[model samples]
Target: MSTEKVRAYQPETKPKRKQKQVKVKVTKKKWISTGEKYLYSVISGAMLCACAYVISFSSATDSLNRDIESMEGKIQEQQSVNNSLSYEAEQLRNPERILEIAKKHGLDIKQSQVKQAGTVSAD
Candidate 1:
């Protein structure tokens, strides 16, 4: 009974093995990868080009509108000049004015038959 009690109280005779220290490699993650950076750059460049195109198109449209307005003004001025010239031509074609001019040119006409010219249209 004494031997059984001493053996029960004795520790195990097995050699203790040392625990292996595992080295964990802690790698810091990059905020942006190389591929992501290139994609972002391409997108930004495309946006910039699009903005430039829109601005240039707007400027060209404004210039075209200005030119059109200037042409319209010129056309109106020309129309006014044509109207005055047409009025002067009608005054010159008056029958009374023609008779006065013919008399001043020493044209002796016993018959005061003044025929008005008319436009002949082929209908």
Candidate 2:
């Protein structure tokens, strides 16, 4: 048997702080539930869908209005063309103008070359 020396355990003493110690703040962390997270995701998805619907509706309204404006412009243009054509027709119907144009085209307008039509009444 060998001779051995055993050491005794000693506790360390704490040092005294003179000034008031600042309290260390411990923040509590809140954890979200899986169900709550899923609910939030569903709500967000529904809101996104509603917003997209509104945006598409507004876009369609704008497109329709633009098409209507373009059609109105075309209608106005056609009306102007119609008015010009009517004016030209009235100008062409002048007897003096007709005679002048006929003379220029070497067309004869003798009274014997015209024929009278018989009048018929619809019953």
Candidate 3:
């Protein structure tokens, strides 16, 4: 019987490679056209005018509400004065009030004898 010799095989290793760096150039771009620029300015001006109009409208509405409230207060005051005047008018129409006024003015109330009053008064 003959013995054969065995050879061990070694694993292969890969070589390391160097990485290359890339350079990028950045450039500025003009994205607006002349016609678009004019349109944008017009739109901005219109927006500003609209905002001003809204503010003015709100102020006017607030002023109108204040005026309405003031007018209502005046109407209430006038109604109270009218009621007071009406009560005074009613008091003036009373018989006691009329007698008091007559007494204050020094007018006299008279009583007469029946036969003498009848003889004297027809003319």
Candidate 4:
């Protein structure tokens, strides 16, 4: 029951090389139904919400990906440090190197004082 309507075309006519002007009127279809208008508004709102969600999701995903890369780099660095420390530990545990350093300090190992490992006496 809406009285409002839209004009399809309006024309302005003027006499060629003369003093005359005319206005022409054209009538078009009337306004759409209330249900159609409501449908249009609802569709527009839904589209807007969908676009906003996509934008927010993409930005958040990008930030999380950056954090993952940073953490991976830190893990690699720590693993490298751990490997270096392991190598140093290996060098320190060498028996020949330990004995060489002990000799420098004038420490001697007597053979009789050395007990065979895991040897058991029945007594």
Best by lDDT: 1
Q: Quote the RMSD, in angstroms, for model 3.
A: 12.7
**C-alpha lDDT of candidate 2 relative to the true structure:** 0.82
Q: For candidate 1, give the lDDT of residue 92.
A: 93
Each candidate's TM vs. the true structure? 0.70, 0.53, 0.56, 0.63
> What residue runs in model 1 are displaced by over 4 Å at the alpha carbon?
1-24, 117-123
CA lDDT scores, all candidates in order: 0.95, 0.82, 0.79, 0.82
Give the distance in Å from residue 57's predicted Cα in candidate 3 to where it truly belongs. Answer: 1.7
Best candidate, TM-score: 1
Candidate 3 positional error at 98, Å: 1.3
lDDT of 1 by residue, 63-97 (tens): 99999999999999999999999999999999999
Scored by Cα lDDT, where does model 3 land?
0.79
Instruction: List, residue by residue over 21-42, the lDDT tens digit for candidate 4.
Output: 7888887866997899999999
Candidate ordering by lDDT (highest first): 1, 2, 4, 3
lDDT of each residue in 16-83, candidate 2, tens digit only: 77998799999876598788999999999999999999999999999999999999999999999999
lDDT tens digits by residue: candidate 3, 7-99: 224344678688797898987776997899999999999999999999999999999999999999999999999999999977867766666
Better of 1 and 4 by lDDT: 1
